[model samples]
Target: MTDLLFQAFIAAGGTAGFCIIFRVPLREIPICAIIGAAGWILYNVVLLTGDDNKVFATFLAAALVGLLSEIAARIFKEPTTLFTVPGVLSLVPGFHIFKAMEAVMDNNMDSSESWVTITFKLAAAIALGLLAIGAIFNAAHAIFNKTKHVTTDMMGTLKNMTTPPGKK
Candidate 1:
């Protein structure tokens, strides 16, 4: 739909702006923008299922962003935060913060409390999602490097065994 495209465009632009403000590499700006757009789109799609669980939607979106950021970090040899920090900007509950402030200004304690609770939940979901992906990738990387070292050591031992004793 046109609306979805428009939202994606907005998210990308916001992400690009964030990169610009933070002085991210020029070459990385577009990649960060795409990551942000993808995350926002995914959040929207998940919400469309009518589950009404914005926290879960945010968690999934942040996880997707984390996954993409890790892949991009490997391919580009840049820090994952360079991609992930900007990529998650779109999912931040800015509207909820505004609503909470407005409720406070109007002396509506109940509404303000509800908005604050939801905002905190959404923020936690994002953090947990990113943490989950980072742990998985780090564990995998460690396992892979361990295996590579073992294989290299085995190759060296095999070479030593095949040589004649007088060769030294």
Candidate 2:
């Protein structure tokens, strides 16, 4: 448990640093940090479970973080893309991508295959992450639009009551 917590802290810190380095909005930094921490925790859990479905786990983690990020964006009235980018940075599979490219450059077929597998896993993770973000943003937008319409109607009614009808 302690290890997990430490890892989470590290991931969050790293994410926050990245955001700061890139001059991301201060308001969005914490959200990105929290999401990063959660993603790392999920990654560690999946790794420890010794399950064969590692790819699935990675995908689920990414999706969850992405959804959370979208929700945060809605709450803060900022662009979800900004938050999601930093939030999901921790799960970008940088090592896998690098290894795959390296293998190809070296002409090592077996290594290349292994690296390709990693690439596929990373791709699935990214896809799942995107799906979650899209779903959450769509739902949030629908709800927000409905609420806005209701509020606008109510305000119009109040204005009508206060104003004398047919005033020039």
Candidate 3:
């Protein structure tokens, strides 16, 4: 329990730091930080579970983080990409990709295979992350718009829409 809490704090602090450095809104900082922390926790859980499929675990965690970030953005009425991008930084799989490339460069076949596996995992994670975020955001937008009220046009025409038909 303590370990988990500590991990969460680290993840949140790192995410909040990124937001501050990037000049993200103060109001959105806590949301992004929590999202990052959740992603890290999920990642650690998968690692500790002794699952052989690290790739799948990584991808799932990233996708989840992305989706949550999008949700936070919508809730806060901010740019979805802005929140999601920073929140997912902790799960970007950069080290895996680097190790894969290093293995190839060193001409070690065994190391190369291990690195290749990691590379694939990282690639899958990124791809799934982007896909999940895009799908969730799109779906949420649709649903929210459908449930929102309509508006009027300049010529007194009834503009039946959920949002204001402009970027927020």
Candidate 4:
């Protein structure tokens, strides 16, 4: 769809601009742009496929972005946040959040509640999707690196295994 492609292009450009502001390494800006575009295109396509399921569409898009972030982080040796922060900028419903706050100040309780509900649903969808993917990737990374509970305070089980029985 022309609209989808156009939106994707804009998303990519926006991501690049954010990356610049974030001081992301210049060499990786293009990759982050592509990731943002891909996520947006996927989100748009999901929305077009059925009833207006903004939550599900956002969830899928965030999942896609997380997957890309994991892959890019592994390949580029950069933190996933480096790519994810800018990549997700396109999906945030900024206008809705603004409207919700404005409605609250205007004493429009019904409108404020509606907007708040919608914004929370969308945000939860995105957060859950990213959380799911991140947990999986963390598990995989720990396994590959042989670091038991790498992110926890517990000591590495594999590190003990590697040390000799007589070693301190």
lDDT of each: 0.91, 0.80, 0.80, 0.89
132-160 per-residue lDDT for model 2 (tens digits): 66886788776875533232264465432
What TM-score, to 2 decimals, does candidate 4 have?
Answer: 0.86
Task: Report how far off residue 36 is in candidate 2 (Å).
Answer: 0.9
The CA lDDT at 28 in model 3 is 80
* All candidates: TM-score: 0.85, 0.76, 0.74, 0.86
- Compare the candidates by lDDT and give the number of the best one: 1
Worst 10 residues of 1 by lDDT: 146-155
Clashing pairs in 4: none
lDDT of each residue in 1-168, candidate 4, tens digit only? 789889988999999999999999999999999999988899999988889999899999999999999999989999999989998888888988999999999999999999999999989988988999999998987788786432323564444453356646
For every candidate structure, what is the RMSD over all alpha carbons to the true structure, in angstroms? 7.0, 6.8, 5.2, 4.0
Residue pairs with colliding backbones in model 3 are none
Output the worst ten-in-a-row residue range by lDDT, candidate 4: 149-158
Identify the runs in model 1 with alpha carbons over 4 angstroms from their true place: 147-168
Cα misplacement distance, residue 95 of candidate 3 (Å): 2.0
Using TM-score, rank the candidates from best to worst: 4, 1, 2, 3
